[model samples]
Target: MDADATARLLCVGDIDMDLIVRVPAPPSRDGKVDGRRIAQTPGGMAANVAVAARRLGTRTRLLGAVGDDALGREALAALTSEGLDLSHVATRHGEATFFCVILVDDEGEKSLVKVMSPAFLPRADEIMAAAFAGVAHVHLTVARADPGLAVAAMARAAGATLSLDLEAADLPADLPQGGGALADLLASVDLLFVSDRSRAAVEPVLGPLTSEGRAVITTRGRQGAMLERSGTRTQIPGHRVPVTDTSGAGDAFAGAFLSAMLDGADDATALCRANAAAALSTRAYGAQAGAPTAAEMAAFLDVDGVRDA
Candidate 1:
């Protein structure tokens, strides 16, 4: 791969340990049910996306905060094993690492319960202009306001395309009491990732985000995904795969699609690549385990009549 063609990504967001349990159904009130299986893995929107990009042969850097605890060490080790640049990952004291409990039902539906640790200090002063050199894209999960805004500003000033995962539910509590802040953020983002669940909250503020130049990509789980751009909408068909857990499928799709775009792929081709990755990610129990390599992606896409658009 040509180094210049593909972007060196900078992913700024959250990291957590995910405890995934497979259950037959929600337990009856005051009742107990046995879980089919349990798996503990690294999971967080921003961290998952960075790992996905790296697995697909993109140079990626992950910047986030974690506590100085056992879970934090484990999460850091997991990310380091994936070969992501973690020089920017901050370690804070007096707090435990964040984590989530994910329950997956028989139908592959997931319900997440997250616990956030104390906020880490802002790293805006550490963000140097030189850090963006040769970086083609900056991806953010706006779980907190300060860091996200700082990174967005730096990415823009460095001439890199800016992307955001609208983690609306996790936005900082201190943000101005209105949707105005969100609307302003949406106006400048080049690519936006919104889950089907978040589309309602986002659309009411920004209206339909698709326009002549900006693009808003929505992930609809098994229904595939839609790319809205240039006043047009393109349906990227979903691939059928044996579902294990749907924990990080959307994050995988976002990372793969952005990496493809940085490599100069057309919208259709990028979406195809992303969809293939997301589909393949469901074949395993954990988010990172199912992330496909470039070779795996090619093989998956080569089967049957599948072809790049």
Candidate 2:
């Protein structure tokens, strides 16, 4: 598919309100410290990625659920303001919107506390079917439901490529442990993006890397990212930038990477652009606020000696 024609990718995941507080340090027990500032923004893995993709010059659509509260309305408005198609975003009554309180220390490290209502979980069938329509690729982010598997199956049925963002979360014992089901889902995905912490939990379940069906990638913070496929592992170094907030760096990477892949850039080049984008995202406060536009990412990539891989 042509780069411009690669528009219409579908993003299925959560949309939430992010409350980012910058403080000198984490408070100790029985101690109190006033935060420097607090900023509320639109967040959630899927929403961040979709906004980043759109800012990077890709047409995108989002399918998810939010509450009917003010926060949910603000979240939906925020995404719509960014030009994402929100036709599939459901608003559930009597549920508070999912929200996260992010604490960022002086060095830019962050700790997150999230509160979610069960109503935020999207119905697997509805989101999957809505996202598959006229979409070239389907990207799934972490959610309480097993919608990832449903979207993967639907993408296959529609002959579209599948991508996933693997996140760390507490799973019920009855569900597949250590990402076994995630590994099986990866078998049908064209690309899988995971964090280094996720590797410790998922590697044992996935075993050795194989490229027969997908590319497995792990993001290593400042160290950059690694791609393992068909027994060959390639490392892409990250760009060094002044740190301000690290909240949405991973989502930025995933968004830029998917945009590059859809643009027909090779894995290495795509990762380079992604790394640049992610690094840039930390140079400012707030998640979507820090995401670079296509021009900004291109300039950074050029300065970093990144070319088509």
Which one wins on lDDT? 2
The sequence of per-residue lDDT tens digits that candidate 1 reaches over residues 112-187 is 8887676333367656676676788999877344666677778899888889888557655444544455656666
Task: Candidate 1: list runs displaced more than 4 Å.
Answer: 1-7, 28-32, 119-130, 171-178
Error of 2 at 79 (Å): 0.7
TM per candidate: 0.90, 0.90
> In order, what is each prediction's RMSD in angstroms?
3.1, 3.1
Q: Local distance difference test, per candidate?
A: 0.80, 0.81
lDDT (10s digit) by residue, model 2, range 101-178: 888999998878888786455775466564577788888886233876777788888788988786656344445644
| Pairs of residues clashing in candidate 2 | 211-230
- Which window of ten consecutive residues has the lowest lDDT sum in model 2? 170-179
Candidate 1: minimum summed lDDT over ten consecutive residues — where?
A: 171-180
